[model samples]
Structure formats: C-alpha cells, structure tokens
Target: MIHPPDRPTELGPGGDNAIAHAMGVAADEWTLLILRYALQDGVRRTAQWQQVLPISSAVLASRLRRMTELGLFSPVEDEEGAAYHLTPRGAALWPVLVCIWAWEARWAEGHPLCLPRMRHLVCGHQFEPCMACRTCGGLVEPREVTGSFGPSGSWPRSAPNTTMRRRSSGSANLGPGFFPESRALIGNRWSAAMLGAAYLGAHRFSEFQRRLGAPATVIADRLRTFRSLGVLEVLGDADRTDRHHYRLTDKGRAFFPVVMSAIEWGQRWFLAPEGPAVVFRHRGSDHPFSVLLLCSACSRPLTGKEMTVD
Candidate 1:
C-alpha cells in the first residue's frame, strides 16, 4: 500500500475510511477546476488563468501554492516569470475530469458554463467515460457488487451491514452506509467554491483570495490540510513563496471520482432551477457523451439499488 509519508494510518478527515478521506479532500471545487484547466487548456500562468476565468489574484495564488505542495504541478522559469505545469501524477486525473463533464452534460440541465466535447483518442470517436472493472474488464453493476469494511473499523453506527438491490429481482433496496461516509469534507461551501476556482486555472494567492472572498486564514488552513494529507505539494525552489507552484499527488488525483460522483448526484437530486449547470462532450468528436459508473472488478455499471453490501 502507498502510505503517505505524513499520514501513517489515519483515513478520512474525520478518521473514517481511506475512500471517505479522499472524498473529503477532493470535495473542493476550485481545486478540481484548476486541475481541469491544466489538463485541458494547458493554462500555466497566473494572468492567463485570470484572463479566462473569474477568480481574483489572491485566492488564486493561495490555491496554487497549496497545489504545489501536493505535487500536482511544478513551477518552471518562463520568459516573463514562471508557469505551473502538471506533473505525471496530476495528469492521471484526466479520466475523472471527463467523468464529471459527462455527468453534468447528460444529467444536469442548463448552467452557464459550456462543456467541451471530449474525444477518446483510443477509440478515435467522441465518447463519454464509463467505469469498468479494473480486474475483469467487465461492466460493474450495483447489484453484483459488495464491499467490506477495512481495518479502520469506524463504520457509522447506523450502517453496520449494507445490502444491494437486485435488478433482475426487481427489488430496489439500498442499505445504509451506501456512501460509506458523510459529505462533510467536500460539501463545505467555502472549500467547494475554492476548489472550483482552482480547477478553472487560478494559481496565484491573490487570485485565489480575490475569487473566493474567503478569509486569508481559511484559505491557509485548507491548503495546509491538503498538503498534510499528501494531496498536494510544492514544486521546485520557487521564485516567490506565495507565487510558488503547487501540484497534486497521486492521492489527490485519485479524488477525482468523488468530485465526479458528487456532480452526478447533485444533477439528479439537487439540480439548479435552470437545469444542468454545464455540459461535456467528447473532446475529439466535439459531440456530447455520457458518464457511467462501473465496478473496478466486474466492470458492470453500478446503480444505487443494484449494489450489494457486505
């Protein structure tokens, strides 16, 4: 197992499970937005991000600094000053980004942001991302899946043993602890907003502060927390401290699923009045696509009622 240098055994911001902890860390929208721009738009400079997005200078910088500490990006000397580039670890989140876009476009209806079509380079066609079992390469279905608690042993008292409904049986019974943890970490309003801004390409401290409207201390605390969790790290010897580049670690990159899943849930349960906020398509085809969640082992699409609890 890849234990972070800092955290030896703790999981979840609240000490739940490893998966829950990851969700809590990634629940920040600004961070995800920053990652998105890095992956899709190749944005690297402070002004370049601000020029395209709505974030101010301070908050942007704060998030960037935090990201640098996570190892998601690196700072390189540029002709003008410096630019933040995504590391290989950070680049691994491309699928998650695609998943988020797919969920928003197909499920969430009218939002202001327009999604770009994603092309599947492997298939040579515009297609949405779907989950598949890493083990069997089959589609994962909810009913066929089951989960067991790990050593953490902190399962919420309310959810001791969960069960999945059988699609073929036509029973839609979902057990407790289905999500495995509370949405507290990512659900925080400030954290979500900041993460969203970061994903949009904000990188400078001032830029983050201006866009988030959050207190300096709040930004600092969250960034520090992310760094401590091994989600983000600092780049090379940066020219400036605040202007230093930040990047995501593999752990941080893994949180992409939580973000995408949350977006899908919001689109279905708590959509905005206008409908879906944004749409995503195959980048190569420039055509709309779909998002499917599959089992890592079975490769079947997972549904709420279909998952089985162990």
Candidate 2:
C-alpha cells in the first residue's frame, strides 16, 4: 500500500498558481460527486451521500474531510446528528455536476436508474446547463475565441522533476483507489485530446483526425466509442457523410467542465517556456478570461480557507 506522503493528495502545482492549488484540493474522484449530492439532492449527512453514491464509508469520510478542508462543505447541526451542506463555494459546483449528469444521461440512456427529470425554473422545462461566456452569454465554444498567456502560464518553464509516473490515466504515481467512471472515460491521452478538439469546434471526422494527428484507425476507434457512449452523435441530415459531421450531444457538451478543468490545471502546472498553447476568450472583447474557480455567492475567487466544515 502507498503511504500518505507518497500519494500527494494536494492538487495543482504549488506556489504562485493559486487556482491550480485550489483545483488540487479536490482532485479526488468522489469529492465532486459528494458536492453534487449536496447541491442537487440536498444530501447533507455523511450517511446520505454514502447511500446515494457508490462509495465506501472510509472513502466517504476521508473525502468529506478533504472537501471540508477545501471549503466546499460546511457543517450544520440538526436534530438527528452532524450533517454537511454546500457552502456557496461548494454550491458553485452545481452547474458542473448538472452538466455531468446531463452527459451521463445522454450516454447511458435506458439504464433504468437515470436521475429524475430536471426542470428548468425559467422555462419550466427540462434543461441542460451549458458553459457560456460571461461576456457574450454564448456557448463556450473553444474555437471562436483566442487568449494570451496568464502569469501562471508563462512561469514553470517546464514541469520539474517529480516522482509522478505519467500513465494513460495520468495518475499512476498519484496512488490508487480513485477509479471513477469519469477517469475511465478520459483515461487515455488521445481520447481526451479528441474531446478537447471537439469542444474547440472539430465537428467532422477529418477535423478530429487533423487536430489530434491521431491515425485514422485510432480516430475511427475513438469516434465509434464516443458515438456508442452518446458523447458524439452523427449529424444524419447535414448533407455531409454520416461520419463527417458528428457533434457533441447534450452529455458531451455537459462534459465541458472536465475538459476545461484539465486544461485549466495544465495552464498552470504544465506549460512550455513559450507560454500557454491555447487560451479561450469571448470574441467581442479583447480581454481574455481564463476559466476561474469563483464562488457561487459573492463571485469572489474560491479558496479552501474561506469557510469551515465539521
């Protein structure tokens, strides 16, 4: 078994990369799901989350403590026992969770255990949340915008020597036991690159092939898998070849945060000496707005110390 210091649970590169550091705080797979239940299902007690999610009690208790350390959860006393609730910072993850659920429902249709229907308060209909531009309110299409290197992007020069043994899942050295389905999906570098390219407006088979530079066979295999998984859907009537104009489904679009989070983390932790390879910004304005971890309540940036958890 790996020792505690060997696992290195703290996320992001330390020093100067505050967002990177913050992202590191909740890098565990179950933490996000814990936040999801707290935000959506009103699951406050430790037992409630353990019951609803596929997690063990030991793991649940550990993650709850970690999330508490990250300020994602706050303790509240009630009649029965100790309970947990989403702090505003924790509630901010609702969209990310909703999108994840939307993606799961899209890909895992007819599973019989799908989440209950979600109703949009504004439209009074089921709605899928989207990541849109803060400035334009348009979908956060990766291809439509350009950005420059932030301070964090320029520093680091290169990833320093570390014990991390990079693997397809990017967690070989980070220890074991974090085997979420989300990790399984983007475990491979090529799969993740393909998805990122898709978010960057690569709708066609040729587009994916060109952007990823992956061989035709690999591209075809990934595409077929994504199609089967409901992340990509064929544009049947686009006047193009069936395989040429695939698009992101509701679930695929909802997985944007996963992609964005990885990219955001990389922007700080892993960068070339030249700077960030790509940055996203709204077209209307010249100012580039990197995806920030902001609080849902005050719109301030999120750090773990702002609140406490029991």
Candidate 3:
C-alpha cells in the first residue's frame, strides 16, 4: 500500500522534478509543433521545418538550439547538409503527442482542419488511444488515480524560466493538428502548474497563489483563461470574493492521460537527486501508477514505431 509523505521534501536547483523539467523542454507551442512535424511528417531539415511551420527563422533557430541543449533533438551532419533528428528521448514523446491528438479530436469542435486518424499497425485498425495502468493491465481513469508532490514540487525550484512566446493573434494559421486548448493548458508553465495543483486539490484563489508562489495578476489571468476555455469553473458565493472556488470541469479532468503520460516520460528521462517531484498511484491496484497508451480498438499497448498518423 502507498502512503503519503510525512512532510514536503524540499528540492534544490538540481532537484528531481520530472514534470517541471519536461515542461521546460517540450511544453512550448513551437517545441510541440516541431516534435509533431518530426514525428508525424518525417521532417528533419531546418528548411523542411520552416516550410511546414509558420514560425520565423530566428524563433525556429532559438527553439532548435534550446531543444538540442535539452537533449530532445540531436544535430546531424548529412550528405545533404545539416539536419536534426529526434533523439531516443525526443522520440519517447509520441504517447504524449498521441494523447493530445486524442483529446482534441474528442473535445474540440468546428476545427478548420480535420485531425488525422491514428492507425495502430499492430491491430491494423484506425482507433483512438486509451490510458491503461501497466501494473494491472486495466483501463485507468481520473478518479482511479491519485497524485502527490515530492521535494521538487515547490515553484521556485521547479518552475522553468524559459521565456514563453506570447500567444499570437494568428493562432488559426498554425495549420492542422495544433492543440490550442492543450497548448494553453500545458504550453505555459504557470498554467500547467496551476492545473496540476488543481488536480491535487488546490481550489481557492489564495490556495493557487500560495502553492505556486506566482504573481496574483498572472494567476488571475490564468484563472480567467481556464474559465473561458471551459476547462475550469468558478463555484460558490458569487458576491464573496474569497468564497469563489475554482474547480476543474469534466473537460479539464479529461486531460489526465496527457498529464500522466508527461509525468511518466519526465520521470523516465529527467532524473533528480531528491527523487520524483510527483507521484501517482493506482487506487484500484494499490501499485505505482505506470501509464500505458493502449489502442482503443485492439486494447494492445501502442509504441511510437507501431502507430502512424494518416
């Protein structure tokens, strides 16, 4: 049986906060786009990425440099000039990408471009992806999973200081398969942190501010954005400011698989001396939560190489 920590563990600069570390590396819209193209379209050359993405050269270069430093992409010199390939670490993000696609396909409405159909090669069927617990080999749900923080959970130690690109007015031009809501929720570190806090039962406005140590204005802006996106709802006394309780909507809760996949990936790739910043356990099996992306059609575990976007 799993037990809660006796006291919050404090993480230093080199602390092991997998989720935050992962967010620092791949949570940006540009990074996500680059990974999506590389994984789905076999994009490698810098020129190829420029042609496919609406990003500027300077920003693209910056993203590539940072991603390479983060160990996601490896620079390769080929016969045809310079190119980038997903390192094993980068390629492991396939499940996180697939979960985003699956969520957007189900919840997002009236998108200008149709999302691609995912084909599971093993099952030979076009299907949706589902989250399953690797230990028991059973389907997992939001309610069945419990998350807790470790020493790396503190905002100061875990928050990524990378400068985020401000949301552009021309988001619609981001082409097909871009996850706007997911991007809003996860691309920004503060937004992702607050959402993670919410999942861990942080409800009041003060609670969010206290736990994240974020500026009140930024927290307020994110709360408003969450409400506008239908991911969170404000409940309780309308007139009383302190009584307002922020809660995740059903839509918000549905993002669990993406979060879990990211946490699992982070834990695997980014290690901290203090240990994992977050821990998730399966309530039904009382075992460590191990996320497995399974094909909705055949219920077989899906791997990066075995799935194709069509």
Which candidate comes out best when scored by lDDT? 3
**Model 2 regions lying over 4 Å from their true place:** 1-29, 76-79, 108-112, 147-149, 154-181, 186-254, 261-279, 284-310
Candidate 1 regions off by >4 Å? 1-17, 153-186, 189-310
Better of 1 and 3 by lDDT: 3
Question: Per-model C-alpha lDDT, please?
Answer: 0.47, 0.53, 0.79
Instruction: Look at candidate 2 and tell me the lDDT of residue 212.
Output: 60
Question: Taking the candidates one at a time, how many backbone clashes does each contain?
Answer: 81, 2, 2
Q: Rank the models by TM-score, top first.
A: 3, 2, 1
- All models, RMSD in angstroms: 21.6, 9.6, 5.8
lDDT by residue for model 1 over 178-209, one digit each (tens)? 11111222445455445444444456566667
| TM-score of each model, paired residue for residue | 0.48, 0.54, 0.89
The best candidate in terms of TM-score:
3
The TM-score obtained by model 2 is: 0.54
Q: Higher-lDDT candidate among 2 and 3?
A: 3
Clashes of 1: 81
Q: What digit string (tens of lDDT, one per residue) describes model 3 on residues 145-208?
A: 8877775666655566663474574654665767777877877778888888888899999999
- How far out, in Å, is residue 198 in model 3? 0.8
